[model samples]
Target: MHLQVRIDIQRRRQFIQIATFGVLLIVHQHHTGQADPDDHRLRVFYPRRPKAHRITEHMDRHLIVVSDVIEPEVEHVLSAGLSAFNDQMTGINDRQSLAVTVRNPDTHQVLGGITGRTSLGLLFLDLFYLPESLRGSGLGSRLLNAYEEEGRRRGCRSAVLYTLSFQAPQFYEKHGWQRFGEVPCDPPGTSRVFMSKAL
Candidate 1:
């Protein structure tokens, strides 16, 4: 029982740390983009928890590593931790996998499709891909529509996604998705466009 309590407390601290970091990054980004310091006001979300102390203590016990390759084990750990915290915070632990796959009719091999999830009344589109030969054949739109329809069936009220500037922004716009923000990224003049739609 004592160990469980300790684990719960640690998860809460980690949640607070992650939330605070996001708030700080937004504030810093806004401030940095402005030509004058006073042009934008810096707002902070101060959690009741001892954020500095808790973060320091937590960081001291953990090993931080940077890598270029995909690590499924690391992803699982982070996802599990965040899911627990989200469940505790909102009291809604409904995270359903949403996907629309394109498979070879002959071999039943999955080629490309859309992958996403719906949680807390929101649908998140994480990735979407289709072969070059399949583009402009109306299959992409069909797959996207199917994904969104399933999200609605799963009780999601809104959907969010990010696409590269050179990618399918116009396609999404034509299908009722609106741009909310854009952040410049690599390859020069390219950016990641964040979009959303009300289901």
Candidate 2:
């Protein structure tokens, strides 16, 4: 009888200890920055326009704006169908691609161009360009803003991208992103900087 009584007391003591440890763990997590994983995520939805303005290409001698879907026409021009081959070979790989071209609209003389990509919860600013005539007129700013807005609409909480040292790191910094990491090039010599922004 005494042995059974002692065993019961020991079990009760262990239960109390476990309960106290669980409470302390929860309190410590709350005091720190950790929350329950299930409680930490938020979902947001963006209302869509019944008719979103289709981004179209403007054909001016000095400038043009266009959006390209990887389809028959783009595939034909690249001489590769819209399959694995085209995706691998195209200079720009984006699900939704948009661009502004500075060129002779009639001749389609491409002088300079810009490109952007948007996909599931992410937006990438892949490329930008301007002819000598259009560099200082704030086109780059407009493009960046457009991409951010689009990213928000796509339910993205953040946008990420990279730039080379010779590229526009300072420009992205000015637009409200911070550098998170960098790779100084491929095979030990490419010198690239990575950055990201929260929307």
Candidate 3:
């Protein structure tokens, strides 16, 4: 009888330990917004459902604005969505980006730079910036030329970029880039000009 009692106690202890572990696991999942491995659906945990619903309703009613903060994960999701759409539309996904920087030789401080991607036989200049001190000093031209040369080496035939009306449209034109399109934008009279050049 004692042996049988001891066996029953052991079974009860094991069951309790497993039950406690299961509860803890569920609690952890609830707190961390982690879903079960078998569940492929995305999950987000909120402390209160009412608040979450209010926020969702606000987003549905208004233009979502998250003040000036850069959310890298959100950006990654957006980029991934576009890339997936592009891949679906075109079987060729040969897009590759390159960044070029100019720095002070002595201080190694970055002075100016350009970044863009090459795809579909074209180089898309996404971002280009040179300090006011370096503008019109021939450094901008050298940097632009070097980037185009690199793009040519990478099999890009044409290059395209955009600049605001108040920005470097004339600078790009002076570098042999031809204005191809203009998009009217905010603040009324201003526009964004698209330019391109054969590499």
lDDT of each: 0.74, 0.57, 0.70
TM-score winner among the candidates?
A: 1
Residue 185's C-alpha lDDT in candidate 1? Answer: 99
Each model's TM-score, in the order given? 0.66, 0.44, 0.61
- Per-residue alpha-carbon lDDT of model 1 for 2-101, expressed as tens digits? 1110111221122222233333211111223334433322233332223223222235346333345557987899899999999999998889888799
Backbone clash pairs for candidate 2 read 57-65, 58-65, 184-191, 185-190, 185-191
Ranking by lDDT: 1, 3, 2
lDDT of 3 at 28: 14
Pairs that collide in candidate 1 are none
lDDT of 2 by residue, 1-199 (tens): 1111111122112111112223211001112346343343221112211122222332332222233345576558665455446466765544566554567779978876656766545777677666658666887677678768877776677888888877678888999989998877665666788889989
With candidate 3 superimposed using the best TM-score fit, by how many Å does residue 3's alpha carbon deviate from the native?
Answer: 59
Runs in model 3 deviating more than 4 A are 1-70, 186-188
Task: Report how far off residue 133 is in candidate 3 (Å).
Answer: 1.8
TM-score of 3: 0.61
